[model samples]
Target: MLAGKRILLIIGGGIAAFKTPELIRALRGAGAAVTPVLTRAGAEFVTPLTISSLAGEVAHGDLFDLTHEAEIGHIQLSRAADLVVVVPATADLMAKMAQGLANDLASTLLLATDKRVLIAPAMNVRMWEHAATQRNIATLKSDGVLFAGPTDGDMACGEFGPGRMVEPLEIKSAIEAALSDGPLKGRHILVTSGPTHEPIDPVRYIANRSSGAQGTALAEALRDLGARVSFITGPASVPPPAGVTVTRVETAREMQAAVQAALPADAAIFAAAVADWRVENAASKKMKKDGSGALPTLAFAENPDILAQVSQMTSGRPALVVGFAAETHDVQRHATEKRARKGCDWIVANDVSPETGIMGGSENAVTVIDDKGAEQWDRMSKADTARRLAARIAAALGAS
Candidate 1:
């Protein structure tokens, strides 16, 4: 996906800095020409020679290498790449970036760059979660700087939280998403993911088996195509993808409101397994399981149909409205009916019977139903399915 792209990788000071060599290799394998800029603190964790060797190019370090400056000015270096990537972006570096500090070579380049910046933050758990750091992160996000992850896991420090840098492969995926000249560029796409949790009580809720894997993949695929994605997700098992605006919701009502709020989008893909009903008269506090002879009876109320509502919009409706139908029997029939019932432009139907293992699994076999007819797609990885769907969406929108 990154073929012929030029990436400026800024390595910052952190134990995670040691992982940049692998990142460099991954980028190169994807055909991205990498230019390494090793920070002074980054040099402590990994040698400039190793970074340069792995990237197959000389690493830039000094802020004012007279000879280097003469050859390629700092401004030119900053603007030369398709994208700027900061791996192991330390808390200090993040602070500097947020504060517009440019004291060294790395900071100077970042400040001078006109290109989009993607940062993979890596720091101690406390440092990553600190209020100041959180504020700085918010500031940077508001400024339109992209971010991959400081995924939750074991960190170099003894304690663990959401500070560990994501693996090279994930970073590679992010880089691809960041740099791809996808057909959906400049388009705004709204995607809903995961199973909505309809609250039964303060402590418990009604939920589904959806892991959100498919929806996350679809959102990522759309984003890779350069769409400005508004990812409205439930409490999903998989983390949300990078390079998109993510809004997390828990219940069907909240999800509906969020979807409505992300209005005037070019397209809307409703992939969430939203609960059809919610418990009426839900308990404000945890209901005690008192040893009464009889069990408590629960009343049900219908939840807002987000997909139907969006599809049947009279004003400011999206150009494309897509819905998903997960059925156990007669998938095609049900999906075809659903497309008409919901007034959506298209319907993606898949068997989610427990026996099929497609509900929470990594692969999907689906038939996309549109006004023209049903297009049966063979079983494939969810990522591939999403990519295909995104392509179709791009083409359909282009034609429209």
Candidate 2:
């Protein structure tokens, strides 16, 4: 996906800088021509020789070097690449970029470059959660900057939270996405993911095994294609992409209201595993186990169907409506029937039976059913599926 692309890498000063050599190699291996820009402070963490050796080219550090400026100027270099990638995007660099400060060559290029910017932020957990960083990230996303990951894990500071740079492979994918033409650009897409937990009491509720991985990935992929994504998600195990506007809901009804509020979308993919039924009469207080000879009888009531509601809208209905089918038996048949009943354009069916292990699992095997026919895909990582689906969406949106 990154073939023939000129990737300008800006390495920031952080412990995460130790990962840049691998990133440089990853970019080159993916058939991208790499240009390394080392921040003055970045030099302390990783040697220029490492970057030069991996990229097979000399690295650039100083902004005022006469020889470097005379040939390929900083301004020109910044705008020359198809994409600008910031690895270990430090909190300082993020602040500078957000505030339009160009004291250094890196910041100057970032501000002056015409190319799309992709940032992989890596910092301490506290720093990441800090109000300033969050504010900067929000602003950057609003400004159309692309961000890959800051996966949650142990940090160099010896504390764990949410401030870790994404792996090189993930960044590579995001870069490919950035370089690709905006497929769903100018389109609005609404997607619901995860499992809604219906409260029966203060301490207990009904829930499903949905990881929200597929739906979250779909939303991110849509955003990568330049679509404006509005996400209505139940309590997801995983967080949604930073760029997407998300509304959190706990029950099927809450999700429905959130979806309806985000109307007039160009398309919607209902991937949430909404409960078919909730306790007809939920306990106002926590129900305790009392000395009883028999178990308590609970009555259930049906929940509203969100997909059908959105797809069957009389006014301002999206051009495309997509639904998900998670079934243990007769998967494709059920999905085909669902497409018609729900008034949707597509049904992405996946078997979540215990044997499939897809429920709350990272990998998935999906069969897409539409008016055309069913196309079953080999079981692969959910992230890969997201990429393939995003490409198809771009194509479809283009034709539409």
Best by TM-score: 1
- Candidate 1: TM-score? 0.78
Give the per-residue lDDT of model 2 (tens digit) for 105-203. Answer: 789889989888888999998998899998898788667676776767898778996788877777776776566567676677888999999888888
Clashing pairs in 1: none
Native-referenced Cα lDDT, model 1: 0.89
Q: Against the true structure, what is each candidate's TM-score? A: 0.78, 0.70
Clash count per candidate: 0, 0
Of candidate 2, the 10-residue stretch with the lowest lDDT total is 239-248
Tens-digit lDDT track of model 1 for 141-224 = 667677777677887668887788888788887777777677887688899999999887888999999999999999998988
Q: What is the C-alpha lDDT of each candidate?
A: 0.89, 0.85
